[model samples]
Target chain A: MMNSPICSMLDIEFPLLAFSHCRDVVAAVSKAGGMGVFGAVNLSPERLREELDWIDAHADGKPYGVDLIVPNKFAGKGEKLDTGRLIDSIPQEHKDFASGILAEHDIATDELDRTRGISGNFARNLRAEGAASSLEVAFEYPIKLIANALGVPPQVMLDLGKQHGVPVAALVGAKEHAVAQVNAGVDILVVAGGEAGGHCGDVSTMVLIPEVARALKEVGADTPILAAGGITTGEQMAAAIAMGAAGAWCGSVWLTTAEAETNPVVKEKMLAASSRDTVRSRSRTGKPSRQLRSPWTDAWEGEDAPEPLPMPLQSMVSEPALRQIDKLSQSGHQGAKDLATYWVGQGVGLMNQPLSSGQVVQQFKEEFAEAFERLSASLGD
Target chain B: MMNSPICSMLDIEFPLLAFSHCRDVVAAVSKAGGMGVFGAVNLSPERLREELDWIDAHADGKPYGVDLIVPNKFAGKGEKLDTGRLIDSIPQEHKDFASGILAEHDIATDELDRTRGISGNFARNLRAEGAASSLEVAFEYPIKLIANALGVPPQVMLDLGKQHGVPVAALVGAKEHAVAQVNAGVDILVVAGGEAGGHCGDVSTMVLIPEVARALKEVGADTPILAAGGITTGEQMAAAIAMGAAGAWCGSVWLTTAEAETNPVVKEKMLAASSRDTVRSRSRTGKPSRQLRSPWTDAWEGEDAPEPLPMPLQSMVSEPALRQIDKLSQSGHQGAKDLATYWVGQGVGLMNQPLSSGQVVQQFKEEFAEAFERLSASLGD
Candidate 1:
């Protein structure tokens, strides 16, 4: 069979799209013939500019993409609220809880202040500004695509892509959401189901792919669908294509690549994780995302665990705790290290070893070929 | 939340039934208030009689159950093939392939004859004989329930249960499956989803529970639905109840219990396993079952690996490999140990420690109570 239109059109050998904030992985995956999507969520404008510039120079002329988090659901949207007002709107109890957790870990109070405002409108505004600046950096290079995660891309992102003659992709979970993205002029739809890493919805890819593909066709929308969630090997990709997806979009498999910017301690945990090690919780981004269930997630569960605040509010409550935990984890603090968690997909279970991005891509091709041969053999009399 | 009717009617305090072949765990879970359903699939009639006798002597008058694998879909109700004829029907190449793998692992070939006639008629006969003997032993005691695992219980099992005035339960995966069981006159339906360990169907607990509940309501079938899959903690039990399930049917959680028959080495792996460690593959049972993905599973997945035969054919291929691997794993042969795999649920990730069955039940109660309180606190706010 011919490669899926989405994969072929994106000029990648595999439909896999590796999402990471690490520049090294972006460069590596692009070099390996799978698209690397730079996560622009946590980057500052200047930092993103530098990172994109680095990727542009180091990506070996292979195509790559950029991922921006633009939530369709957000607090204070269209209110024109200032950062101070939004910060003030956050409950003090939540802040105190985060502070007390960090204090218990013996993180200095001054460093805590530096971490205090790590959330709120400051981060949102930074993400927004960073997206815009990163768009400039991306346009300066030969970027293949730009994807908006968590929501529909703003009109400016679409316009920027149009102006650059590049495809603007949108990540969506539900079929209705896919239709909305298609209506919003999204060039490609990254259909992520509940089994995907990070923020996801409540549908498995087995059901979600065909549902979205049929929905797109019925609406006469030509938007190509890239299936995401719990997909790892070539056989899974073949199954997704057979189910009507234009291609498969992957993330978790790349998290353990040689170039990944994963926490050493957390990476060790991930190396041993099976497909069942994940839980979908809103503790991270205020949206339900699958991550390795560590003590940190367990704390937000069970009795006595605080009720996770809504999306952005939840971020304010947990981000500081995460920051401190990561710091102590880096320094070999055992208890804090046990609590450090990272976003991963259920497919992490299939990623049994750490290989270079190029080796991973090669393995997929080999596995895919064998799987197809087996399928054909089974079909024969 | 009130306990489900299946539990209440059966006089069992909890709906979570720990299904296993181990006598100690069966006895422990029964004493812990949760019903234990002993899997009689592999047990010989005499062995099953002995185990049931032990349970009868040890069980503290708590309600318990027995599980038998009686496939609704199987070869020859009318075809009427003998065990020897069915064994002859299996391809010689498959047997040769299995032999090569076993020999390569240094497993004794002397037991090959004993292993060859496993799964299909072999399985059917074993379960039927064992179930009959188990039923005899069970009837001698105060057995509260009897369950058919793979499909709706045979009419004989239902008849026996009816004669004994005990409820007959059937395990199902989908809403339609639940309806079928209910229509077949099943008194209890264990609605297991894809996230569950062992042999299961394609559905998640979140969507499956409500769907099955709605289906049963629409069909006017009052058969109680016990939600199974990915349920470990009491909070999950509460959530399952909220989703209309009478109670949670759990198994993987009990595998790590102190009295479990799981290999100590494998138990260590299970303890360290995050939710991501499981995969649904038919390599073991010739029918899909959620299992911990180990080097054993990886061997089956490789290009050089023999394609697993279907149903009874594949069981003959797997039983010997599993037995040999388990033996070698105990001896600390790293390669053989690596190949050791076990059927477990996605909830294995929640089992971080080896607790007694009673401790697990107690913890579930505590967490469930807290979750209810939290939900109540959020109400009328």
Candidate 2:
């Protein structure tokens, strides 16, 4: 196997780190030689423990990781607001707006699980204390790495990673953020660009990788960087490595994998969508998050629409409605189908067909080899 | 000298294409072993001839190219609208808004040159017929390439390119646009990302290059691509090539070069700015063009501000105010200094100091070599 510092550090065959929410996809990717990082943002500590247990049994002793979202700021952040209070804090106007949109689509809002079974736990889990519970559970498994999205991982998260002998990674959108992460003692830097799915900043991946890499090198920090955002193929991975990244950290590509638990309707949209189908809107999380553009997104962008509320509040407004939409869309409601959307990058245009998680990894290996060969071939003797 | 297909095609020592509006910067870049493409959108046919004549005299036998903005859609694109007619079409409200901005800053709006020297010629030169006149002058010189921004080159431009043995290139923001350009018989594709300066699309360079490359290859089109947008260094140039591009077509990097004609105040801002300092706003060109953020941009984005008039009309309103601002800012006026801005990319953050055009080229070569070596080192035997 080709060796990189990240591969050696993580003890993985290839340096490709797959970010997915599906346990099956995570295990399949790890078994196929790449490190599968299960996104644990939406899971309770008990559910997370159960999910990690399943991956531990299915991953065949391969190294894997977990990713958690411990943002630097969110609604009721550092204030300790309970779920009922947080929910109450949401303005009736926003709730009415969300419900109004669903009603327009003929989807019953009551059928949607507003509390998602964790009634007041959503705000708690996103806070430092809740992340600790999830982290504690994650460390119980034989995980090799842990990553935080949205901002620098808290010092506690970093300290736990050190105590558990696992490396901690932080995702940054710009060079200064990378510098801050290094100052915070992050073990790995996942430099994601604006083209990335989920939350992203305006800087593109092509410029951000080299920008972060050069900034780190200049500051005498040797932190390994994994380039993320809008990257869907082996050639892109090879391009990232060539540009000074340790590897390519991918998320959106896995959404179409056979083992992914993505909404079937959304997956079909992703398969049929072009690069232009995605838009970076704050409608989902209150911060700018790239997702497939639908009537739902369009309505939010309309002139009369109110600006999306900040994180946690926006999630509260969107998730219940979207969950209802996903369920109805799956059941073949025409309006729900038209209004369906999910987090995806512009690379969705290229993701035309569905492949198994293992197949995707295998193709990445081959494509990366081919791209490397092409680059070497360009360097004439 | 590094050899690539684009280098061979353009007959340059390296595959780096420097896009600059300054003739001196263009000539210096060409003399430094890369192709310098002079942006001729703002020049009249007679002035363009003079610029090309100077480049031809001073380029020292190195190949250079010319770039023109013959956009597919613009104000009075098909109909022949004379300059007075075009300027007369500007709404009183837009003119008042622009003048009001200058008034608020204590700058005398009446002293500004409303005609900007070219008079009605500005609208004329952007049309097909006007572009043809400039093309006639460009072909008179020993030009090796010609490119069109905003859309595919018209059939006449393509035919003229073929007849003159100059490869015609078009800048595309999406894969579908690349296919359209290839189908339009364009010889080279300049895939620009949203991070690019001036006009850009939503797709980022990291995703756009590989996306266009793969899309073209899938359709059996072997057109060479010149990766562009927010690219400011040799390492970025190396990254573009590794992602299957034949070369890097950079624009904003030259704005800070010692030989550039960029406004002195704006140049200083570019030197001190970070990647996040630029914002894509239609307030400048009526189409979203990335420029340095200032009080001018902020005012346009303000709630009570009117929407920027489309293309030519917006230019009419802004050009008068900005030209006045640029002149006063250069003369040490405090209010003008705060309001001055210019077209630049996100890469402005990396452009810390002013260097000679030749030094910038030399730095790129060395940085590219270092990056290439780094990639090879990562590929273990």
TM-score of chain B of each: 0.90, 0.96
DockQ of each: 0.02, 0.63
Judge candidate 1 at residue B211 and give its lDDT. Answer: 56
Output the number of the TM-score-best candidate.
2
- Sorted into a CAPRI-style docking class, model 2 comes out as medium
> Which ranges of candidate 2 are over 4 A from the true structure?
A110-119, B82-88, B117-119
- The local distance difference test score of model 2 is 0.86
lDDT string, candidate 2, B28-146, tens digits? 99999999999888888889989998999999999999998777777677897666776788788888898999999999877766566234555666678888888888999889999
Could you give candidate 1's per-residue lDDT for residues B216-328 as a string of tens digits? 87788777778788777775665556545677778888888888888988899988875557788877867788899886676666657666666666776677667777877
| Regions of candidate 1 where Cα sits further than 4 Å from its true position | A78-88, A96-111, A114-133, B1-381
Say which docking band candidate 1 falls in.
incorrect
> Candidate 2 residues A250-288, lDDT tens each?
999999999998999999999999888999999888989
